[model samples]
Target: MTGGTGLFISFEGIDGSGKSTQARLLAEHLRSTGREVVLTREPGGSPGAEEIRALVLQGDPERWSAETELLLFTAARRDHLERTIRPALARGATVICDRFADSTRMYQGLSRGDLRGAVDTLHALMIGVEPDLTLLIDMDPEAALARAKARATAEERFEDFGLPLQQKMRAGFLALAAEFSGRFRIVDGNRAPEAVAQDVRAALQAQA
Candidate 1:
């Protein structure tokens, strides 16, 4: 919205909110509309970040300290931003990421303390390159957790957290939406995937 360079869009939500599905759909739509686009996800977009993603999601990051997990997230973000996100935008391509720095804040913040330092440092390090738009796909905690559990062939680190933690994570997302205001849009994630996709398209077009 601000320059001749390409745009960066990020999709964020608690697990099972269908943000990933919607991100894919949006990328497809952009391709169909004849825009150059690259579809990727946080924690594992690039090789370096993928390594960090394994550590963050593979075994039991929930079992570790909240602060440690938050650091890992930022580490992954640094790798992702350097190797993937920034480069795509510089090349004049729309980069659609399924998750981004906002997830770190919500997840870490929900763990009952601030990741303010981490968030600040990440913003400082990244400087002027950040997502142009972030769509936060919102859904009910109970339903989202239920869907996630059923869909999971096996649990990942964060996914293994208790119900109370999941609730906090869900609330954290909405809180983040409130905090960021106009930069983030909340999408109804409980509907059909196609319906959700349409909502995302409208939001992106509105911003355009």
Candidate 2:
């Protein structure tokens, strides 16, 4: 639970599954209801972590080995927890994170290599926290990859890994949702944005 009065929420899905858009929409919805919402994203929430984001997100996909990427992501996550997430939670604000440790669990742990054990170990040793609710925006991997590639952003390292990786990630995320079913909610992302947002709200209400 965050060990705080505030609620912590995270969005997870394959690349371009609209999880980021849903995260923003949820934050806005919460703020409209006059709740204190701290909208944030992992790997770059705090200043120090933003620097790490640039290093790990850009460049070639093979720039760093899975082990190295895991270390870098863990460092950024620790900084983010200390500087951003914990403080926001302490102040009793709803924290809507675009992604969290689960992303690392998929990208570095399962997709890149069999490092799920190492990822969990580092998570326990350093950033010992998880969201109160995780909304997985489930969708078709080919469509998601197409949407991700359409962005043409510099942070396309993972997108560069292509559709097969996206398919693998989609399956991995669904498995993760099942593994953490107590706190995970699967939301279909193939509908219109407003419709998807409605489902997102429904999920949160269900959690509440």
Considering every candidate listed, which one attains the maximal lDDT?
2
Residue lDDT tens for model 2, 46-110: 99999999999999989999999999999999999999999999999999999999999999999
**Per-residue lDDT over 1-208 for candidate 1, one digit per residue giving the tens place of the 0 to 100 score:** 3243889899998887888889999999999989999899987899988887767677754465777776777777777777877778778999999888787777775554676676667656653355789999998888887877787644366667757767888788888889887788999998999999999999999998
Off by over 4 Å in 1: 1-4, 61-63, 126-128, 153-155
Clashing pairs in 1: none
> What shift in Å separates residue 1 of candidate 2 from its native position after superposition?
2.0
> Worst ten-residue run, lDDT, model 1?
121-130
True-vs-predicted CA distance for residue 118, candidate 2, Å: 0.3
- Which residue segments of model 2 deviate by more than 4 Å? none
- State the displacement of the C-alpha of residue 40, model 2, in Å, after optimal TM-score superposition: 0.4
Cα lDDT over the full model 2: 0.96
